[model samples]
Target chain A: MVISRILQKTGFYFLIILVLLFTLFPFVQMLSTSLKHQYDWGNPSLIPQKLNWSSYSELLGFQKKEVKVPESIHRLLNNPKLSAEKRQKILDRFTSTSDVFPFINYFINTLLIAGTAAAISLLFAVFGAYSFSRVRYRGRSGIQRGVLLTYMFGGVLLMVPLYQISVQVGLANTSTGSILTLVVIYVVQTLPVSLYMLGNYFRSIPESLEEAAQIDGCSRFKTIFLIIVPLSLPMLVTVYIYAFMIAWNEYLFASVFLKNFNEFYTLPIGLKSLFVSKNAIWDRIMAASILTALPVVFVFMTFEKHLIGGLTEGGVKE
Target chain B: MVSHPGSLAQQEARFGWKTVAPSLLLIALLIVYPVAYNLYLSFFEVKLSGQNEFVGFNNYIDLLADRAFYDSLTVTVIYVVGSTLGTTLLGLGVASLMNHKFPLRGLVRGLVLLPYIAPLISEVFAWQFIFDPVNGIYNHMTVEVLGISDERVNLIGTPGNALLVVIIFDIWKNFPFAYLMILSRLQSINNDLYEAATLDGANRWQRFWNITLPELRFVVGAIVMLRFIWNINKFDEVFLLAPNVKTLPIYTYFTAFTGTIEQGLAAAIAVVQFLLLIGLIFLYIRRVLKW
Candidate 1:
């Protein structure tokens, strides 16, 4: 019995290690590859032979000289069948020195878009959730059901019309356009879940606190701002993080809407463009990929408990 | 003046609508309007110049008959089933393992969620590099170290292997979500039931089959349903990892934007997808979530 128990314990640890390696190996590969020189691309070893910062420097625009245009873009530009106007446009769009490795721009764009979207959504969701949870209203249950239904349908289904709408509303291929579209989309996409989570949270807070505030001559909005908001700060942070992650990591919409505008490209789009471009620099691509993922990873590692609690709370309650 | 019903309640309701209107308007414009517009566009042939000609279900008919559509549907079903089942079962297994007392369990638990929480582009690129035919570690291991193959195989370059790679990627990236969900529920399971089962002379497997599986059924069901819905519409990972793994969304995207630029056909595809999703949502709400 003792031998068998020892065998079982060994097997368990082995399995745990195996699982951990599987989960983390990609990240390890990415970090190692990012630190590798161009000559080490085909190296079988996971670690770099000589750690290099050139990839990061070049991608982050710390390198002084402009990198040459990829042969593929030049070939496309030189195609005889292509109209001169289209060629000129392509040259204007992609051949700019700054456009070659706009990593910092993309990072800043992601932060701006995601930060604004998260903050705006939190504001809207809080008010919306408060009404659903605390305020007695007509069509309350019907609207609540509507919110849940909206949550069910995936956003990819909306891409086609959304693209068309973006074009029609002058929201395509510009930084402001992408930011506005993302903010609106994120607000709507996040509001339902945030409302659900925050509504439940608000419902759990004792009504006596609000009643006492009201009795002390506080208005309804004042009661919420003074009492409820302070009490729900943790939940608000959870929701904000969730929203921020969604907007930050969103690739499909950003890819579709911002494909024409290199300056407006977010991190995912920038990283993907690097992959698709001919004469691809693997090290720079890997570095950009790591940089893109670093913020979210840091946030997740730091606030993991709150993040998981918020996610599961939403899931379990639903 | 005669008061109709409760005036105070009426005032509260008015105030509630005022508070909710901004959110309602945003959702209406962004979600509700787009959905309705998509449905409308599905029946018309949309041109690049923003011109539309009423086609009256031809797009849908063509979509049903198209070989590529059928191919995408088959791939979608396989991918969704494979991923949903793989993630949930893996999650259940890992969660069960982690439920036990162990050294460094907290750190391990925290690290396990990295794949799910990491940016999708980063993870997808990492996987792509890992599977690259010439330079990737996967090829290197399979060809040089293991001597399993004489020549390096392009895992993400070919269609069949690309699908397999994508399925594996989905499972790997997403099982953490299932693990987290299941683990949370696992922690709340009453230990007394397990103690009772043990005292009644049941073995570990039997106790798990009876107590644990039954307790986990609802949470597992919910996770499976949610994963299914998400995976059915999953575009980013598949597109980024291997564009050739043309799931429904990828197919719709290429059809609409890249290849044919047939917005109407894409809209039709979206409509069909939306209908299928509605069916799934109904099942999810009624059977799984019981919301």
Candidate 2:
């Protein structure tokens, strides 16, 4: 009996360790490679020979070490009669001013746009979900059903017509126009699920609380932001995280609308451009990859306490 | 402001409309109109010069006649079914494991979700490197660690091999979602059921087979169908990881966005995919979700 109990414990721990290893190995590999020097690229070991932090430093804009430029830029700069404006333009290639993987710029752009869109979606969904859940109205259930239906619509169906609509509205060429277009599109993509999640969570909050709030002189609108929204804080965070991620990681529509606007590139587009432009440097690529994912993971972990799985009972993945 | 019965009801209805108006307006413009516009565009040969000639059913004819369309359809079916089943099962397995007591169980749970939580761009790069022929850990594992083979394995280079790689990649990326849903329901299940089963002389496996599986059927069914719906529309997952694997989204992407710019045909393909998706969603909501 003792032997059987020991064997069962060993088996259980073995499974746990196996799962941990499988889940973490890729991340470990990526981190290891990001810290490796150029010579260590061929090494299969998880640890670098000497840990190199230059990629992270450079990517995060802390250090400005002069790296080797491509031969084409060197060749262009060698011309003696090159105009000063054009010469500085060519030299700006190495600086953050030029088009070379501006990680900071892209990071800021993604943060502002995705963050703003998610905030807007969350604020609206709070009200929409409140109405959908508590208020009695005609066609209310029909609209709820419709929200789920729209959520199910494949994005590919919208890409072409959406692009056309953006173009027609003069929202495709300029940076602000594209930014607005992406915000609207992101809101559309994330709103249904946000409403769905908050609605489910809101419905669970007892109506007696709202009745009490109303009896205390709060209007229905104020009652929501004041009482209801505060009550569902965890679910609200869950909704914001979901909405932010949808906009943050979105690539399909971003690719179409922002193709011509390089300065306004989101991370997904910027990262793809990086992959295309600099395919050779493993350290730089992996470094940007790590940095791009850091903010989301940080936000998630900081709010990990709210990961009450019950909050997302029927909610599927974003 | 206490009012008559009909007046208060009228005021509540108006408040509901006022609250949801922004969402409804945005939905109408972006989703509803785009859906209708896509259907309308399917009937025309959309050109760059703003002269869209009505092509009627010809675009659909061309799409049906094209061999690549059929090939991609087959691949999409396989990819969706394979990826969905893999995620659901793996999710159930992992959730079941973590449901039990263990050391650092909370940490392990968080770490497992890392795959799902990581950004696609970052994860895709890691995966691309992992499948890299020369220095990838995949090659290192199969060739050196496990001694499964001596030659370096190239999983994403060829079309047939690429499909399997993308499906596996998707499973790794998405299973946490199913795990999250199932584990919540699993925890809610009453322990009395299990206690009774044990007292009735049921073995652990038999108890799990009878009670746990039946309890999870609804959640699992909803998850599997939702995965089916989402996977069919997935683009960046496969595109960023292995651009060569032409699932339907990528297929439509190539058609509409690039390479010949046959917008009409692409629109038709999207229309068909949307129709199929509507059917699936209705079935999912009515049958699995029972909404």
Candidate 1 ranges beyond 4 A from true positions: A66-100, A173-175, A315-318, B1-5, B280-291
Docking quality tier of model 2 = medium
Q: Candidate 2: misplaced stretches above 4 Å?
A: A67-99, A308-311, A315-317, B1-5, B144-147, B280-291
Q: lDDT tens digits, residues A169-234, model 1?
A: 777757677668867887777778888888989999999999999999999989989999999998
Using all chains and alpha carbons, the TM-scores for the candidates as numbered come to: 0.92, 0.93
Best by DockQ: 2
Provide the lDDT at A23 for model 2. Answer: 75
Model 1 complex DockQ against the native:
0.63
- Itemize residue pairs with steric clashes in candidate 2: none
User: Across residues A100-146, which tens digit of lDDT does each residue of candidate 2 receive?
Assistant: 46899999999998999999988888888888999999999999998
Question: How accurate locally, in lDDT, is each candidate?
Answer: 0.86, 0.86
Q: Return the lDDT, model 1, position B212.
A: 93
